[model samples]
Target: MSLPETMQLSLGPVLFYWTRERYADFYREAADWPVEIVYLGESVCSRRRDMKLDDWLGLGRELTQSGKQVVLSSQTLIESEADLRDLRRLCDNGEFRIEANDQSALQRLSAARLPFVAGAALNLYNPATIAVMARAGMQRWHAPVEMSRNDLARLLADCRSEGLDQPCEVFAHGHLPLAWSSRCFTARHHRKPKDRCQFVCRQHPEGLALRSQESKEVFTLNGIQTLSGACQDLRHEVSDMAGMGVGVARLSPRAEGMAGVVAAFDAARRGELSAPDPLALVEAEICDGYWHARPGMDNSRATTAP
Candidate 1:
């Protein structure tokens, strides 16, 4: 099948804690990457204040000047009044669009009548839910991480029947975010309370890997967010997603080798099958079972060299 000419690549927001300088350098280099869109801001935990709202807006402006579309993302878990205030500030930033990661963000943005990009954490499942979000001024949305390709195709078909045209973006690559908790898993791992974590998450930029009794990697602990142990690679399915009317492919940020990930996806979109395999550039095992309607950890398809 022919790839959709309009399908674009997006860099998802940074999900792990990093030093302020490291965050700045990442975006500075990402400006030259192949992605057309970039989501900025700390989306995982509220205690991660390395970069504040003004800092994020400043970075967004820089990226915008570099010819990339930037969207300010809201925190996924709103546990405090401080978090609410941050969300309000993000919604009123007046510069870049917002990516609503939770219900609070959606409410604030909708109340202000501003259009937003719905984050995957919103858990939008069917066309009926998407129609409601569309009416609430959602201009784009990320498919839930567990949504199968067949489910997405069916959802898109239903949206078309209802005349809902908001663009759908898939979490095409990176560690799949599985859950968020009020307690800080990283802090607990360090034998500290959530309030006294002392910012230990910074030590593990990619996240603390969790393993099962059999010593198999299972999940990753990043502050309050739980992520998949194996990186989810969907480069092989980009053409199928394009054919299903997906408008954007989102790659979650990793601590290293992001340039290769962007290049590999770009090559896939352009049908350059000879590009270097993105799987080779990452440290974790790769999986695509969720995309194929199987267990999330299963890699149903055999790996093929690109």
Candidate 2:
């Protein structure tokens, strides 16, 4: 089967610790956004309980009412009984689709015989892995960050040959979620233990900044997640992704100026995008090397400086 010319847009789960009011306002406003799918839930540290399951379900209902496919995402690192309980509840809801972010959640979800969306955190690198998960009932799979255009093309081909049905979604914008560890960087930075973080990450909604060994602005530190400092702008590759069988472009939420971010990506996908200083207003610098199969940090735009 051939892919469509226009790729769909999807807003990924909000990964920061925003206040209840801020969180409500953000999704409430997003209820009208033209994205095809919206994944909502606490995918980061669970201690940051700014919103509860009921609140998330309420927003999911609202978004679903607005005709958007809503997926409640499971936690990335489920280490607590409470987290596991929440995961069970989310998957058991039977009302909204769920995104499995970790192995534990995936195992439980599989055991329950419930189908779930494959969150990007899943290691779906090749055709064999993709086929394995597809057979296990992954209706849709999120493309990993470091996976490339060619790799995805082969996976798509294999999906077709193996009859592993699923829609492909790519991480288009937002800081690249590099890694998640059991240790909290925020607490480590302050010389505090993980058990007593004092919620330091809540202060920097986007995340704390980290410089490179060369003293260059490089990475951002979230509780236990290290992310690329650059806001990945793959709008330019919207058409390319679609050609390679990508159905949706997944955009991660940022603290400030999400409306503009959505609009810019929407416009770019339609090939009607034109803006002055588009790069300057970005909350972080831009990166697209992984999409182009180049080094993650080096900018293709910078190399061809003509």
lDDT of 1 by residue, 1-306 (tens): 347778999999999999999999999999999899999999998888878888998999999999999999899989989999888988998989999999999999999999999999899998889989999999999999999999999999989999998999999989999999998989999999999999999999999999999887899899999999888999878888888899999999999999998998898898885644444447887888899998888765445453
Q: Show the colliding residue pairs in model 1.
A: none
Q: lDDT of each model, Cα atoms only? A: 0.90, 0.82
Q: Where does candidate 2 clash, by residue pair?
A: none
| TM-score, one value per model | 0.96, 0.93
Q: Summarize candidate 2's per-residue lDDT along 166-224 as a digit string, tens digits.
A: 88889998889989888999889988898898988888889888988987659889898
Deviating ranges (above 4 Å) for candidate 1:
275-279, 302-306
The worst-scoring run of ten residues by lDDT in candidate 1 lies at 273-282
Model number with the top lDDT:
1
TM-score of 2: 0.93
**What's the true lDDT of residue 249 in model 2?**
95
- Per-residue error (Å), model 1, residue 105: 0.8
- Candidate 2: stretches off by over 4 Å: 1-6, 275-281
